[model samples]
Target: MLASLLDSMADSLVCSVELEKTKGITVRVYNESGKLTQTVILDGKSITIKSQGEQKSSTIIQKEDSIISEVKGSEQTSTITQKEDSVVIKCKSFQVDAETVSVKSSKDSTHESGGKLTVTSQKDMSLTSSAKAALKSTQAMDLETNANLTAKATQNVSLSGLNAELKGTTKASVASDTAVEVTGVKVDVKGKAQLTLEGAITSVGENITTVKGQLVKVEGALVKLG
Candidate 1:
C-alpha cells in the first residue's frame, strides 16, 4: 500500500514513513529540491499535519473534539464559507497585529466588549451613516478637538442640559434669520471693555429697567426716557 501510494506521486516527490516506539508514526514528504514539504505525525491520542510551500507554512492539530490550525506567511489571504448556523471562536485572549485589517458584513454585525474597548488611528478617522447615528452614555460624554469642531444639521440642531454655556476667548457672535430671544428668571449681559447694542429696532421691556454707568450717554436721532 505504501509503495503504491509513493508510486502514485510525481517523480520529483519523495515520501518516507518512520515508526518509533514512543512517538508512534511519522510520514514526511520532500520536494524536488530535497526540502521537507509536508509532514504528518499520528500518535494514539492526536494527529498533527504540517505543510510548507515556497513562502507559506501551515499546521493543523486534531485531538478528540477540538482542532487547531495556524498559517503563517508574508502575504496571505483566507476565505471561509459556512452554509448554515454560525461560526464562533472562544479563547482566553485573542489579538491580531497587522498593518491593515478590514471586516465587512452583508447584513448586520455587532461587536461587544465585556471590559474596555478602544480604537485609535494614527492619521485620520471618519464615520458616516446614511440614516441616523446616535451615541448614548450613562454617565458623561466629552468631545474635544485640537483645531476646530463643527456640528451641522439640515433641519435643526438642539442642545439642552441642566446648565449650558458657550464661551470664546476672542469673540463670540449669535445671528438669527428672524428673531433672537433670551429669557430666564434673571438675565445678565456684560462686556469687559465696551458693550454695543445696535439693530434696526431695539426694544427693551421689563418690570423695571435701570441704566447706570460711569458716564451715561444716549445718542440717537430722538431720545426719550420716562
Candidate 2:
C-alpha cells in the first residue's frame, strides 16, 4: 500500500475521511530533492499551513485570518492630480522639474511652517491684483520697523488727489501729531485763522489782525507786534 501510494503520488492526491472515525492527517509536500515546498497540518478543530520559499521574493496567500500585503517594489497611483501637467521626477538621486505646479482646494488653503519660506528671483518679480490688496502686521514694533512701504516710479513720481472735500485739486490730511510744520510755496488758510506773535514780526498780507468791538471793528494793515 505504501509503494502504491508513492507510485500514484506523481500527479495528484485526493482523499475523503471522517475525522471522528480517524485521526487528523498531516500533508507535507516536498520538491524533487525531498525538500519541503509546502505544509498542511490538520488538528482536531484547526488547520495550520505554511509555505516554504525565499520570503523576500514570494507571494503569500492565506485563507484563515486577516490578510496583510507587502510590496518591495515601486507603486503607482491611479490619480496623480486634479490638474493636468507634465512633470519629471528623478529617482537616481532626487529632483523634481515641472513646468507649472498649482495647489488648489475647494475651501481655504493655508501653508504654515516652523522655519522660514524665502523666495528669490533673478530678473523680475511682480505682485499684481485686480482687486484690493493690503499688507499689515499685528506685531509690536516702531514705525520704521513695522512697515516699510517704498514705491519708486522711474519717470514721474507724483501724487494727485481729486479734492474729495470740494477743494480745488487739493490733498488734505488731518494728522494727529505733537507739532506740525507747513513748508511749501505758499500756505493758504481758509477758515477763521489765529496766530500768536511772540517776537517782532513782519506782515505780508492785507489784514494781519482784526480787533472786534460791539458795532465797530479795526483791521491792522502794517502792524508790528512784540
In terms of TM-score, which candidate is strongest?
1
TM-score of each: 0.62, 0.25
| lDDT per residue as tens, model 1, 8-123 | 66456788999998899999998866454899999878898988887888887787766667666766533222224554444455689998899998888787888897988899
Clashing pairs in 2: none
Best candidate (score: lDDT) = 1
> Candidate 1, which segments miss by more than 4 Å at Cα?
1-83
Weakest 10 consecutive residues of candidate 1 by summed lDDT: 77-86
Query: Alpha-carbon error at 81 in model 2, in Å?
Result: 10
**lDDT of candidate 2 over 1-226, digit per residue (tens):** 9988876675453433334334576665655443325656566544545545443222223324422222222332121111133332322333357986667666654655556655566656577855666656566433342344466645644444443232424554544345445555656555444444332553444546554546653347754444
Q: Least lDDT summed over 10 consecutive residues: which range in candidate 2?
A: 76-85
